[model samples]
Target: MILYHTEPDSPVIEISVEGKITDHDLREAIERMRGDLELNGKTRVLERIEHFTGIEPKALWTDITLGVSVARKVTRAAVVADAVWIRASMHLARFFTKAEVKAFHVNELEQARVWINT
Candidate 1:
């Protein structure tokens, strides 16, 4: 499951991923994000992966497509995660985004928010 919320004070869009994240979740998230990007002009993305366990290859592909779409539109991307693999993946993928990608621990969500807002 995925839930999306917009930051009240900024153009940052936050997404929460819980339970199983399927390709459908990725697609829906991307669609909402695209709408947000168009509305915000200068966009930022915050993604929180809390109860998300694993993603399938189709989901991964969707993720890449969404990331690329965000890269073309957003000013920054912040990801808060406890999963080591996800952190590593973000670090590796950072180079592709036009926006900066920063990964933080769940406890550092505030810090991630600061970075994205900045």
Candidate 2:
């Protein structure tokens, strides 16, 4: 499941993920961020992984495609997760994205927020 918290008139989008993520969830989130980027010109993202069990193969593909499509429009991204694999994946994803992507341990969420906002 994916939950979005977008402030009105703000260029920053916050998303929380829980359980297994489906393709539909990823697509919807991408659309939402795209809308924000269209309106704000650019966007920063803060993703909090609460309990990510895994993502479906199709969802993973969709995520990659959509993310690359909007990479240049995203200025920064901060992913907060407890899992080492998740952090590693975020690091790897940075290579494919135009955004300045960073990973933070769950305990460093506040720092992530500050970094993304800056």
Candidate 3:
């Protein structure tokens, strides 16, 4: 399950994932994010991965197709997770995405927000 929300009047999207992301959830998130990006021209994403089992193939494909331009518009990313693999992936994302990505442990969520907002 995915829980998505935004900080009002701010170009920040907060997302928490448990289990897997459904296509409906992905679409709704993309819509809101796209609207924000269109208005602000850039965005910051805060992803909290608690227990991300995985996303389905269709959801992955949808994300890929819809996220290309959206990804570029995200200028900052704050990832809150304790997983080594997620941190490693964030490191790799620096090379591929325009966003300045930072990873933090679950306890450091506040720090991540500060870093992303600054």
Please give each candidate's TM-score: 0.83, 0.90, 0.90
Model 3 lDDT per residue over 1-118, tens place: 8788876688888988878888888888888889988877778999998877888888888888896667778989999986778867887775547888888988999998888788
Q: What digit string (tens of lDDT, one per residue) describes model 2 on residues 1-118?
A: 9998899998899999999999999899888888889999889989999777989999999978786787667889999997888888886775677788999999999999999999
The digit string of per-residue lDDT tens for model 1 on 22-62 reads 88877888888887777778888888988677787898888
Query: Local error of candidate 3 at 77, Å?
Result: 0.4
How good is model 1 by TM-score?
0.83
What would you estimate as the lDDT of candidate 1? 0.81
- Model 2, CA-based lDDT: 0.88
lDDT of 2 at 62: 92
Off by over 4 Å in 2: none
Which of the two candidates, 1 or 3, achieves a greater lDDT against the reference? 3
lDDT of each: 0.81, 0.88, 0.83
What is residue 59's positional error in candidate 2, in angstroms? 1.3
Off by over 4 Å in 1: 65-67
